[model samples]
Target: MHELAIAQSIVALAEQQAQNRHAAAIEEVELEIGVLAGVDVKALDFAMKSSVKGTLMENARIVRHDIAGEGRCGDCANVFPVNRLFENCPACGSYAVNILKGKELRMKSIVMATIGLQP
Candidate 1:
């Protein structure tokens, strides 16, 4: 599934970042996903659970932020909320609309594990 690939990429990114900073592990990771991004959250969650084995994000708390769809009507210049891309403008019922948001899938932040010297 594509979600597995996505999960793999996410884990790889976290590992790369942790390696760069020399962190022992990843504490947390925040992801921003838009409604219009065509991503299945359940599948991604399952994939991530299986993919993070022995990785830097194995114990990290993953947070997901769902972004609402927003679009502007080209005919009336009115902005409105949408759940899908095929939605027409609410103000003028125009099909010519430009999406202002809700097409994103990316990592927002990552919290690295602190390495302390304990004797």
Candidate 2:
């Protein structure tokens, strides 16, 4: 599924970041997934396990943050939250609405283990 590809890409990016910082291992991965992104959180978690098998993030914990979709009405200029995808604005009941947020699939942050030994 598409989620698998996204998971693979996330793992690749995390590995690259870990290498750049000379990290020994990846501890956690924080992701911000928008409601309109159409990503299955459970599927992503499973995909991460398979994708990071040979990478530095093999044991990393995938942390997902779900963001609600938001849009601004072009007619009334009102901003409101949306749970489903559609063209109509909830505030003004206008079809001319612009999406302000959501529909985003991105890795927000990463918690990495130090390269050197720790007590």
Which digits, one per residue and each the tens of the lDDT, describe model 2 over residues 1-119? 99899988998899999999999999999999998888988898888889989889988888889988998888999888877778687666898878888898999999999767756
- Residues 1-119, candidate 1, lDDT per residue (tens digit)? 89899999999999999999989999999999999988899999999999999998999999999999999999999999989979999888899999998999999999998687576
* lDDT score at residue 47, model 1, on the 0-100 scale: 99
TM-score of 1: 0.94
Maximum-TM-score candidate: 1
Error in Å for residue 75 of model 1: 1.1
Question: Per-prediction TM-score, please?
Answer: 0.94, 0.90
How much does candidate 2 score in TM-score? 0.90
List where candidate 1 sits over 4 angstroms from the true fold: 116-119
- Candidate number of the best lDDT: 1
**Backbone clashes, each candidate:** 0, 0
